[model samples]
Target chain A: MATATKMRFGIVIFPGSNCETDTWHALNDQMGAPVDYIWHGETDLSGYDCVILPGGFSYGDYLRTGAVARFSPVMGAVMEFADKGGLVLGICNGFQIMLEAGMLPGAMMRNVCQTLVCKYVHLRVETTDGPYTRAMSKGQVLRIPIAHGEGNYYADEAALADLKRNDQIVFRFSTAEGEITPEANPNGSLENIAGICNRERNVLGLMPHPERCSDPILGSADGRLVWESLLQAV
Target chain B: MAKARVTITLKKTIMDAQGQTVEKALHNLGYEGVGNLRIGKYIEMELNGAPATELPAQVDEMCRRLLANPIIEDFHVEIEE
Candidate 1:
């Protein structure tokens, strides 16, 4: 089995993406893994084991969050990469991009409170069957920070049912003790969904900034488990 | 030459926080009669040279492909030549 250090990570950088450096620092400096920055215009994603769409106001969050960036050329390649069962993770704005690109189901809406929410919150691991969550146990809670104005996740009833039936829900906002509650749901997301993977379990999108919390010096190391899980799976 | 107007708004089932906030502000400002007040986006663009017959479908494609997210919003298009 290839070790985590052997896996190469790629972070896609859109025009307004502000989290690529943080993501790079997490995966490269903190985790000691190989990493690269992929420009939004590039179409080749062949060499990376995992591709991340990091957080930020991509395309200035114009038209709508992630709407314009979805049309970027690299997204075509990202789709192709995921279609081949390659691992992909979208964080925050990246998660929004995934939804706009149709790489994941559902869409994000303005926060129910109509404000930009930025805080450290607890996310309960809803499942560990996928590559992104394999290193964590179901119901385990991790402290992660989320900063966004449109993280309220929504989907049609049929789609929600499909996700539930397929066990695609990977994380949900929860109390430190692992209790799922409306109070814990910072974005008013349906059922407090914080993260979900594709039916194939190779692609995951979440609103939290795991890369920001991957180091103990930064207050928590819980997010490192996500990277560790991918290492184990790939 | 042709001009197109695209209107996009959140689907009725989805909550429009910004719209509601604006509505409340209007009510506070003495416009209490304003009910069901929803906000939406209007985009105007000119197509250099497109047949009137084809403008609707082409603009509809634009709405579906980029102008609006079908999951949470609906769109209407008008074209004039």
Candidate 2:
């Protein structure tokens, strides 16, 4: 097994982002991966092997979720880091920021029910080739929680096809039995996509809170596979 | 100074769940002749200086870059005379 100390994680903190501490603790304490809180105003991320944009109502989700926070100074550094092939993970609101930053293709729209959904959902790992899913076998289902109002992932047909062709689709909402169904999809995301990665496979954006489930006490430590995968890959 | 009014709406193919919900509410309230209610954003901004001369293109840029997300929404800009 790869030692957790091998990977250094930086979780960005934007005003109105309430999940930074959770992410920090998950990485630093629970997973034992060296982690630090990188403020949104910071312009440097050279010290980290991976950058995480943790879930939260960044910039109060003003204008649009992540629309404002994408301009944060740290994002410039984060983008540079991603362009240079460093790993980047965006969870929930962080995923929104990634979409707004154009680091990932597509955008998230209001949930079909037009209400905030926060609960444990089953996600089937769609691809294991990416750094984030290396620990999980294909078709493996993990229990993770998604909390957000805007998680309806959408893209043009061309973009969607491209994502599929490149095997960039990382995970899909699924039933506990690993069956993908509309009833299992908490959000009306296109094709029930819960997560995806860039063509380079370095940047991943998903609408689930993996950090919340990294601890066994949380009732499900399935998310640990992702964190462990990060350490193993780096 | 010149002002630009921007109207942004989801693309035709995209599902507008909020608008659908609002439409259902209107139907329950017995509003007549409500057809295809699609909720959108209306923004008004003021501009000054040389930028005002290039208002249309500038507003287009704004819509493309920030005011609207081209993936799911389309934006129309109207400059005040």
User: DockQ for each candidate?
Assistant: 0.92, 0.85
What lDDT tens digits, residue by residue, belong to model 1 across residues A20-83?
Answer: 9999888888788899999999999988999999999999999989999998999999999999
TM for candidate 2 is 0.97
Question: In model 2, which regions exceed 4 Å deviation?
Answer: A1-4
How many clashes in each structure? 0, 0
- Which ten-residue region of model 2 chain A has the weakest summed lDDT? A1-10
Pairs in clash, predicted candidate 2: none
Residue A153, candidate 2: C-alpha displacement in angstroms: 0.6
- TM-score, one value per model: 0.97, 0.97
CAPRI tier of model 2: high
